[model samples]
Target: MRHLRSLTRTLHKQRIEGVTFHFDPHHQHELSTAVRHFFTTPEQHTPLDTPEATRGVFLLEGERKWVLKHNRLIHWKKQLQNYLGLKKAFGLHDLTNEFINLSAVSAKSACAPSVAAFGYKGRFPFLKEEYLLVGFLDDHCSVDDRLIAHPEQASTLLPQVFDLFARMLDEGFVHMDPHPKNILIAPDGQLRLIDFECCAHSVIDHDFSLGFLMGYFFHYWIKRFIAMDDYRTCCENYLKVEQPTLDRSIFMPVFERFLTGKVSRTTRYAILTSPKAQAAFKAQ
Candidate 1:
């Protein structure tokens, strides 16, 4: 069942049971049917073990691999705020935010995936379900996997990892969740970023703090396996790439807070107690 119809200039749209779908004309031929089936009969799709978002894979022989992100309604409080017109919350619609984020990031970086199609499966003001289909980078492993298998390579890889974040920051974007798992290492040794569902755009004209970026690295990388010295090397690499004038001294407070568990209890507990973090700790 081909559900998509042409709009204009590489755009196509489809509507099914109150849900609307948008697709790239270049990929319409390959994506239309698979997208329809993935949404209409989600139960048949096997879920992928993604840490941040619910995902499912729908592979086709001799074709590009497709991964569908099932965006669940996790931030109810934010959704409520959006509904009440109290504040515009980004969490109200995860798939839509990701679709937009991916588009913006793709325009600036080759490392981000191209969104093939996106759709929502509910009425307005109370969207119940949403999904995004994207071209999967086949045979790539998460940065976490690579770092785990070769702890000694942290010095070599952390700089490349920081470079990726530096580029994104230079492009006026912050990947609110730039954890190791959300970043992938392609067979060619290039770093590609995925899972932009929590990404946000920052003002290009303003000087930005490295607090959030450092926090994510500290939580996912330093706390898990990377030595403090290697992590500092990565931070210096990032400074050289993006903010040469900024003092490394500024990072110490945040870094020490994270290291000493003096940061917010919620964030500290979540990172230290997450199953992925636990597994990484056990493997050490």
Candidate 2:
């Protein structure tokens, strides 16, 4: 039944006002052919996500790639989970709001992929998906990727990672998810953040609470990314004279203990399923 539904599924593209594209060469018309191909050539798509009835694929644009993030109905198991209160309900994916949030956080610490084109598919209430096309960023890679290739790089990158999170908090922005894969190291050494689906920015971002941000990003970063020996350096970078937000006596021990209690991000990212990535992980 689901297969039949998929075979006949129709997409209804929508246009929203005030939305902009990062690609300058009229990305909409330019992407039309590629978008059509994406729907038609299912076998060619390099699967980027899990078991999903809705599609998510890499759309090509000449030399570059873009992410076609489609939001569609959840599976019956997921629906059952929601009904049983065993999991949170999956919400709608609104590309327009995501773009606005991206714009707000640009240049602060990280960035979302520049949206090339986006819209809704099918009717709204159900059996519909809202999607956006964003460029597959080049000249950079995720922090986790960098670490997997060179575990030794952890020492240097971990401190910069902490600083980036701290900078975001200072600049009135709070990212709900700054996980290793979501944080990228740009070519110029600037950190770029992706995945703004759960992120936010505000004039008074502190309403989200700096303490929670610290717990969410900083200490969590330690357990996931920073090694035990590197904790002091990250703490120092974050609590230097210019930014005297937390007391040394309070912050250092907490971070050290956090490091002690959990595996660093470097260790966790060291293991990979891909032979190439695993070989790189071993090479370092």
Candidate 3:
């Protein structure tokens, strides 16, 4: 996997005026004409989407819609390069496909529309990804979207979310991004984890530990700023939930692993600011 450290090397070699010739086998006929027009005489390469790549929405026949994410390397924005690199190295497309397959295999009745991966199609050094289309939840709101209206769900959602984390961990995969935006709740109250862009495989316990630590602190961050009591209740309640399962004292060592800076900045912030997190420090 290409870590983000190599971002500079690729960025320095970029030629705003130069173009690297390549071909797409899947859309050979259509992409050939389109790409040639973008990079013809004058050798001008069309600018890729900005920091958060342009999310192109195209409606397919029969109500199926496609969101085209042109994950390409462009010289103008440095951030796009890093995001694209991570997206490719981690094989997000494959992971998501497996997630969809799991939903089918498990035969879970929850309805979030199993994510379908259309397979990643990218040219080396240039990334362009086409995601497998799914039925969009028009009425169902993301957990993040719901929080704006119902802050009270913090008490209700956080603990349940921790349970979800524990379950995923027990299942041997870490849902890397634990933020509310990636969780979608249907009208039936079935919460589905979406966007497995940063997941990884791990031993069952380690995966659960990492996920639990991630969940514990993630909610604590918001709870601290807006709802302190809820945050405390969440921590205390989680301890209650986890206590009967194991040594009842293993949450800290698991948390310290993520604090080492390998995790995302938001995650780090969440861990550092958690109220119960200090117990881990005092223990050391």
Candidate 4:
């Protein structure tokens, strides 16, 4: 139960040419070597395939598993945002934001991975790359994989998903990307959320509207791999856990919008036509 607040309070900070490096006091001994190896000889580490370019590499030392997330800071879209001052508004650096969010979320729950260390390699307004080291969770499977493997477990697992969302909401937090791939299902059936790159904190009265839930379901389940019946069951189960009186009518518009979006249109067509997607949706 190493809390982020305590860790940050004891963190060792070093500044070089506007680049700031934060190291966990406990792991300072291994920090330099680990950072060197992470950047110079990445091939020595095991590559992890992530949807985004900020992929991770696993570094094993004795029995410890450290995941080094290499996040590139200079991208065309980010550059445009920087010019528009949007980067400053949202702390647009992905790794920095992820580290901050992870620290905040870890303060609330044990769902987020424990951050070991984080640093930016270059100066602001022209920052190069950023990196974050975190402890890896073993024996965990993505929620998407679990749902596809055991669709029958939806009735049992959907409650856990709802509970996690409820806890996050109660804590005044919201995961901008609520995709199944970002959620890990532990062997003991606990739900652990990962990838805080897009997470945000909100006011206590933040809206958890049916529209938001519908869009979440569409992006995480329906557009990917889920049967119509199971999708309905998920919605119903979520309502059972959150608001029993609210019906599905309020969410239909969100679903309709999801279907009409360009990305959703292409994804829906692909899923409908692909044999693999069809098979996964029909999985039991």
Per-model TM-score, in order, reads: 0.72, 0.62, 0.54, 0.71
| 10 residues in a row with least lDDT, candidate 2 | 1-10
The per-residue C-alpha lDDT of model 4 at residue 192 equals: 85
TM-score computed on alpha carbons, candidate 1: 0.72
Model 1 segments more than 4 A misplaced: 1-10, 16-18, 37-46, 50-62, 72-87, 91-93, 203-207, 233-244, 249-284
- Report every candidate's CA lDDT: 0.61, 0.51, 0.44, 0.60
Indicate which candidate wins on TM-score. Answer: 1
1-284 per-residue lDDT for model 3 (tens digits)? 13322322222222222432222233334433443343343123322223344333222322232222223333433233433443332223333233333333223423234432222334444334433333345556777778788876767777666666666556555555566776777787767765544444433344335435554445434443346455656656786667455543455554444433255544433333343543444355
Better of 3 and 4 by TM-score: 4
Q: Which residue pairs does candidate 2 place in steric collision?
A: 12-122, 110-193, 111-193, 224-265, 225-265
In Å, residue 140's CA in model 2 sits off its true spot by: 1.8
Among all candidates shown, the one with the greatest lDDT? 1
Better of 2 and 4 by lDDT: 4
lDDT of 1 by residue, 138-252 (tens): 8999988887898777767767776776667677666666778888999999998888766555532222225446656766555577767767667766667766776545445
* Residue pairs in collision within model 3: 118-132
When 1 and 4 are scored with TM-score, the better candidate is 1
Across residues 75-184, which tens digit of lDDT does each residue of candidate 4 receive?
76663443233443222336666777787777777778888887665433444666687877888998888878976676666667767766667676666566687789
